[model samples]
Target: MTTVTAPPPPAARTATPAPLVSVRGLQVAYGDGPLVLDGVDLDLFPGETVALLGSSGSGKSTLMKSLTGFAPITGGSAQVAGHDVGTLRRGRLRNLRADVGQVFQQFNLVGRLSVLTNVLTGALHGAGPVNAVGGFSSADRQRAMALLDRVGIAHKAKDQARTLSGGQQQRVAIARALMQRPRLILADEPVASLDPTMSHQVLDLLQEIARADGIPVLVSLHVLHLALDHSDRVVGLRHGEVLVSSPTAELDAERLAVVYDVSDADQEADDAGH
Candidate 1:
């Protein structure tokens, strides 16, 4: 007979390990369009949740995409899980993506599939299309079932994805991401479609996962208060640049207000015309 025990505390910040995801002087553009990310820099360390805060068009989504080579990286470098995203060829890029797990606002599930089956699909990331249908091994299925239990939705494993409520479905999405055994997790506005009550629950769960799994979670969020509540560090972007980056313990809504202040953008334009 055995009893579960909590793990020991992490080493001091000075002794913290190197970041799993590192971005430096990053830039992204889409075919003659203006730069969407300009000299952006970010880092995600293990056992931490970094809330990415910004209003619309702040380049939050682009930064996330650049990590896995989904965004066209025009300048600088992004090292994710030890892979240089900007320099990776197609074959290696696929490996880079397999190392990162992603969550979305829409909860992107195959509505007709069972929750368990959907989670199992995460194991298909590196496997070729040959295993897309009915090819999961017993170990993969066991892991998927365990992930569902970890996310607290094991009871709903047999339910159709379309039948679950918004919050429950999001939990399943998270379980699916965990199925990938991801080194870093990126959640793009995962709570945007959820109600306030559900929002807190989902965010709380993400933070818990970060701490327990020792995996860094970089979550983009539009709501300032939610970021304040759910993250260990806060990185706020404005007009494709990082306006503020600090530990959440040192920040408040007042300090974060500039990220959303439209007048700042107007002021920049005014100065540019000079």
Candidate 2:
């Protein structure tokens, strides 16, 4: 008789790095309007993908904007890459933005430029004014090509950005963001315009980048299933407040339903009319 024993279980995962982006009691509002984001707190750790979820007007976009200084913070603190977002001077703010890469729903790209050229533009985030005659350097061009290849679109590097399909255009946008070597990535509704398949592909790519580069990716998403399927953590907002924050493995559609619940007035009105 021979005795067999299974190998001991692997060691528990190491503690995560200090948060690259931190927010506490964050509040935001437009002039004279009600608070768009209220009493929100969030922390983004390196090599993690966090999904922001909410229905329309739920403050998801406002929260993302606050992280980059686009939204006015009425109270609380938001620190990104060691800079206090609300109190940073203009130059420091520019430096902060340079360290943070952004992807938008619209795939903000210059349609007329070649995909490679568009990616190179990412290097301009914190760069001084360029000499029109000198243009991009050989090193910058090579780096841009490499990023395009990483995104699986090196073949489209020579094509006009406008000529590619929606998925392809998004790949170009992602490559462009990577060209910045960002410490944090903010993706605001990044896949809202894509079909279901493209949505999965794009989200998968974002998570891969987060893990491989040790960058924190905070992406706002409308689809519940997508968040559950792609993100490591989920933060749900409702009526300008955080309603839920937990690991994706511990959450499901039932647990998230409260984030999008209808108001009492609406429900009563429906019953009265019936």
Candidate 3:
């Protein structure tokens, strides 16, 4: 009898990648316009919520779009969930979209649809055309309800999406995203429409999901306080450049103001000269 060993347990799969989303020297420009994003580098690792902060037009939205292949990448590379944004073909784009869960500022729910139906739409990305017209399967409905429960809104499942309050609606949006079973999540100013209290609530929820699911959550926020309160790391952009990238505990409002205040100062100087 040959001495058989179990191949040393396959080496414990030790060389796992550091991040689920890796972006290097990412550049994005619209048609013939100047670069909206220039050499931006960001990495979103599992179990972390990275808050992207900047004043308006610092390319925060553009950076998020680049990861999903919505913006034109004039140069550099973006790899999200192991797919190369710059190089993926059409079929791959569908797969990429299916893997990434996106939450928009508007919540993006269909108002007239039942909250559960809206959440069920997320599963469409992973479904075929034949399955769509037939409506959601029992398994999909169950999963959507589970997602709603996870987001603390299972009771609202039968309500029309528009009937919910802003915070509740946002919770529905989050549930919709979770229904995709995404490998990564990108939220663009997810709480900009909510009040201070609701904003805190939503951000806390996002952070909780990131840690619990061990998925990277990249959220853009206009408020410095919110970012500091909820994120594990903060990345600040200024004039389309990365001005600050550091762990949240190591940064504060004063330093972060560099990204927000300078634009105001420049406008003031121009007005004074005029």
Candidate 3, residue 271: lDDT: 28
Best by lDDT: 1
Q: Show where candidate 3 strays beyond 4 Å.
A: 1-17, 263-274
lDDT of each: 0.90, 0.89, 0.89
The residue pairs found clashing in candidate 2 are: none
What local lDDT score does residue 40 receive in model 2, on the 0 to 100 scale? 98
Q: Model 3 reaches what TM-score against the true structure?
A: 0.89
Please report how far candidate 1 places residue 28 from its true position, in Å.
0.9
Better of 1 and 3 by lDDT: 1
Q: 166 in model 3: Cα distance from truth in Å? A: 0.4
RMSD of each: 8.8, 5.9, 6.9
TM-scores of all models?
A: 0.89, 0.89, 0.89
State the lDDT of candidate 1 residue by residue for 76-119, as single tens digits. 99999999899999999989989998999999999999999999
lDDT of 3 by residue, 126-164 (tens): 887865775778999999999999899999999999999
Cand. 2 TM to true fold? 0.89
Q: Candidate 2 on 131-193: residue-level lDDT in tens?
A: 233378788889999999999999999899999999999999999999988999999999999
